[model samples]
Target: MKFTFFTALILLFAPLTSYSLSQISNPNYDPELAEKLGADDYGMKSYILVILKTGENTSINKEMRSNAFVGHMKNINKLVDQKKLIVAGPFGKNNNDFRGIFILDVSSIDEANLLLETDPAIKEKYLKAELYPWYGSAALSEYLESSDKIWKVNP
Candidate 1:
């Protein structure tokens, strides 16, 4: 069979393309860690992601805002210590209507909702939690372990 120039080019690159794809799978794959991380065939696991948005009750009083936020951060620290909260951060410079988000390592959205309720910001109605079912890499669970080497935030 005669092949066109483009077809010949594709044939030449096909093996290299497949080789590049297979390289993504590590040679030192860990089966135990894969199972423990809830990784599926795609190496992704379900998570409850909570978006912290400004509630209907906007803060006019600076003291109340500071108090609630302080408590909210303390609540986040508590969850981190428990290893229930995987990732938390603000969406600054992204856009309006979004303050921050929390990616919980909990098993269910109900658990994540209850955990968010402990935040003073959510409890006081200063910040509302919008929970969503999300799927992300199982390796995301390792962030905190290597975070200490990054830098410390002095309060």
Candidate 2:
């Protein structure tokens, strides 16, 4: 594990795992926040990550490409607004085949795939996606609800 400062605080304060939640008891806990954060007795959840990569069909026309990307952005915002997508962003300054990623609040890879199929970029073959199961803070799902205060945009 990367022993960062915040990670240290998480391990010390947060219930790093379901088992840890069972072991530790915090007297001062907020019920409303707990429910909002999905911290059922254990603060854990199963999430999915979708990676968007350069697909084979990159020879799209310039005009079509612009529309495709705009449509893709709109689709992403739709997913975020729907709370299916927790986090989504493009990779910058990377020469690798990687393009962008989406952290989806879905249980299974199949569910994530179904959501990704709606992307115009993926439909046009400008970007293809690969999904993998991920586990992280259940509270992360709430980030989308508050992110607008920071980003000031639907993204």
Q: What digit string (tens of lDDT, one per residue) describes model 2 on residues 30-128?
A: 778887766667676778988889987867489988888999999988998888989888898677888999999887888888888899889989999
lDDT of each: 0.87, 0.83
Where does candidate 1 have its weakest 10-residue lDDT segment?
146-155
Residue pairs with colliding backbones in model 1 are: none
Q: In lDDT terms, how accurate is model 1?
A: 0.87
List, residue by residue over 7-118, the lDDT tens digit for candidate 1: 9999999999999787676677788888988888678888999888888777699999899989988998899999888999988865567889999987788888888878
Please provide TM-scores, in order, for all candidate models, with all chains considered together.
0.77, 0.76
Candidate number with greatest TM-score: 1
Backbone Cα, N, C clashes tallied per candidate: 0, 0
